[model samples]
Target: MTYDLVVIGAGPAGMSAAIKAAKAGAHVAIIDENPVSGGKLLGQLYHEPDSGWWVGRNIAREMIAKASSLGVAIFRKMEIWGIFPKWNIMLNNGERLTTEHVLIATGAAEKAIPVEGWTKPGVMAIGAAQTLTNFHRVKPGKKVVIIGVDPLSLSVAQELKMAGVEVAGIYPPPATEVSSDKSNPKQIIQGLSAMAHLAPNALLKAAGKAANHPTIKNIAAKCYPSFGVKVWGIPLHLRKTITAIEGEKQVEQVRITAIDGNGNQKNGRTKTMGVDCVCISGGLYPLSELAEAAGCDFVYIEELGGHVPLHSPELETTKDGIYVAGNITGIEGAKVAMAQGELAGTAISSRLGLLQKGSDAISEAQVKVQDARANAVITFQQHIESGREKLAQCWHTNVQTSSGKG
Candidate 1:
């Protein structure tokens, strides 16, 4: 069947895009591989720290309800294998779909961090642990140790703790460095500077102003790289690295080596921690295979979760009639994805004269999207705007290249 807009991936982005387009009178449909919607949002459960309450669960429910109310058709458990220009989508179930405009909101997957015995039975990605505990109500393990120091890892560790799982502690992953990898003390200071926002408003303001300064930046981060041990009740060990997961059947214990401030392992410094589960999380990257297959141009922006499709402020890809949103565009969380999805849907609907009332729909939607982005706390792409701009310029200069070519 042909649709005016066919959105792939039914996550926060896809659902929001379909709802917007359908509200604008376009025949919209959303397809996803999962039997349910919400994507990573379903697995997510945490206090926003800023908001001071646990969210994600009710938000996903509300979004699904709104999409259904808008007459947006949802097709679940349909895995899309290929996407062709003119919006021809082939599915693994031998079903085919056609659309005038396609929005690839396939989102992202967890980045794996391989270590010794990572393939053990109880070892899994932090995302998998989240899915089990939050979605299925199945505790991943009685006790666990999380590997990685990123915000996502920290947040998920908190969730696991709330789920009655004993979280031993959090440690840094093995850094991937080369001879050419220059150590930038400023990077560490910048991260610390950012973390200062978690402090009181007076400190946050001071840190923001001092972040660009060299010496003051270090002073700002003096108390940072520190977790709320009292709140989560989990130790934060930034100086340790997991060397191996030792077990014959399942995860029995993890071996860790002490590291210097430079992230190099200190000679003969090691310890073992017993745990039934080891949740490894390096980070996240966009799942842009469908976008690449559809011939959309991608720019390698590591901050945005590797190669994301090159798009404008309105979320339209370089290719005509194709758009991308959510983590597929970058690894920003659900709020940004929903806003971007709304923008894409509004843009396409306006171009096709699908607006219910008049041209006002487009303008109104644009304003809302802008507000959503401006107010978001987890705006990943904007957080590294300079890096994004540099990557975009680099991609533009080398237009002949395609992602996955290497």
Candidate 2:
């Protein structure tokens, strides 16, 4: 079927794009590999302190309903392997789809901290644990020891605790190339400053701000008690980390060791803690392989959470007629992704010459993306504005170079 737009990924961004474009007199179809729509929304559950609870599953259900009502086709459990010449989509199930416009919103992936026994049955990514508890309503473990101290792990640890699971505590990942400065207690404290705005209380917010300064933060980390501090009733161990997961078969225990504030492992100071499961979170990065396969150019911006395809602020990728929204461009919360989806949809519809009367919707949609970012409750990266400026510069440079070639 040749549709006006084919959105790849049923996550917030893709569904929202499908909804927007379909509303603009364009035939839109959305596809996802999961049997159910929602993507990461299937497991997200949290409170905004001011805005009340953010129930992703409920939001996704509402989006699906609205999109379906607008006559947007929805396909589930279909894996797309390639985007061929002339907008041809090759699905894993021997199906081909043709579309005039494509939006890549495949989202981000959890960067794993691969330590010993991490491949065990009970060890999983922090996101997997959230999915098990929130989405599937299943317990990941009785006593869970989480490795890595970040926003995602902290929230999931609280969730597990709320679900009656024993959260041993949040610990740092062992020092490794993959883990980077995340293994450093001091670095973690510094990085925590970026997440300060998301703290639920004023006291934590103050602490987060205080941690941003090098002198104050270093002194704090150096003086940090050997015993971890309890943040929201969950132990946050900045002075120690999980060095290795241990078990005869599955995950039964983990090796913990104290570290200096600078992140050097303290020798002769290792202990074992009994835990049924281990959740590692090395943070998140954009999953842009599909963007690459679609002939999009990419740039590695640390603030955007790794390699992201070069796209304009309008959400159009380097590849003509191909747009990218959400984490395929950068790792961010779902709200921003949805707004970008709207922007991309509006842009796509305008290109199809269907929005002649409502072309102003393009600018409005662009404002929405900015507003969403400014008001984002949880920001994964700091200096997002600067990161965006850098991305824009790259896009302009590429455009100029391409014009010169022509």
Candidate 3:
């Protein structure tokens, strides 16, 4: 069927854009590969610490409902394997639906870490762990050790804790040496104070309130490390390397060694940590392949987690009738993705002459979307910068090791 707009993926971006375009009197059609339309939002757990803003599924549901109200056509389980420069899309399910405008919202794929024994049954990526627990309702293991210390990994830890699994301490990769001369006393104090205010509430309510009780206060004071010059008031553990994982069919123990400044494992110094499963959280890479295929210009921005297409404030790509939104542009949260979706929809609507572009009608919608984008940029910058060095190190090591194996 010919349409005014054809949205691919049916995730937060595609669904939102479709609904907006349909409401504006455009004949919109959305195609999704999955049986459902909600995308990753449906598979994410509620209790993950940083996953508080997962409105994508809710937005998708609402968008679908609105689109149905507007008589937009939705094709579920339809996979588009190819896109032409003329905006003609090839679907695997033997259907050819052409549109005047196309919006690609196919999101990113998870990258796997290249380590020995990583292909074993018990080793999984953090996203896979989340999907297993949240969607499949299957616990990978009762005891789990998470590698990497970031909001995403921490969220997994919180989920596992709520699932009644024992979470071993998070292990960050070795940090570069801090220069003694450049250390600021005021900055250090501020950091410590922030951690002190934040740490107590990290625990369950009963555990947090028990610290005030006379008996538990003494125990908490003794067990918890003092807030000091450490990183986040928690000591940064330096390690040489994770040597090997040992078990028959499932993981049982992890081998680690202390490393020097150069990352060399100290000889004859090894330690073992017992855990049933290992989860690795490296970082996210932007999925911009489809945007690139649509003739959009891309710039390599390390802070945005790899190559991102150049898009206007209105979320329009270089292509005249094409738009992009959500994590496909950059690795931001679901809230920002939803807002970007709305922005793209409005811009597309204005471009098609279906909605008035500058009649003071779309100004409020534009402002809200721009504000969300600005805030997302600020919050993601810190994470993107801090994560770069570690991710680079891992990437180089993985490439070298994988090449040798090949």
Model 2 weakest 10-residue run by lDDT = 198-207
lDDT of 1 at 105: 93
> Candidates ranked by lDDT, best first?
2, 1, 3
Q: What lDDT would each prediction earn against the true structure?
A: 0.74, 0.87, 0.61
Model 3 lDDT tens row, 1-406: 6888888777777777788778888888888888877676755444223445443356556767887888878888887777776678778977787776888787666555555566677888887787677656678677776655444565566666666667665553332242211122211122222222224244323333553465654353233332211232232232334556677887887776564433444688878888788887666777777777777766666666677666655666657677777777777666566676777777777777888653353566667655765444113333343443444444456457757999
True lDDT of residue 59, candidate 3 = 53
Candidate 2 off by > 4 Å = 201-203, 357-359
Give per-residue CA lDDT, model 1, range 59-142, as digits (tens): 778888988988888888999888877879898889888987999999999878777898999999989999899988999999
- List runs of model 1 lying over 4 Å from the truth: 49-54, 178-231, 356-367, 379-382, 387-406
Question: Which candidate leads in TM-score?
Answer: 2
Ranking by TM-score: 2, 1, 3
Off by over 4 Å in 3: 45-60, 173-241, 259-265, 357-363, 373-406
Clashing pairs in 1: none
Q: List the lowest-lDDT window of 10 residues for candidate 3.
A: 179-188
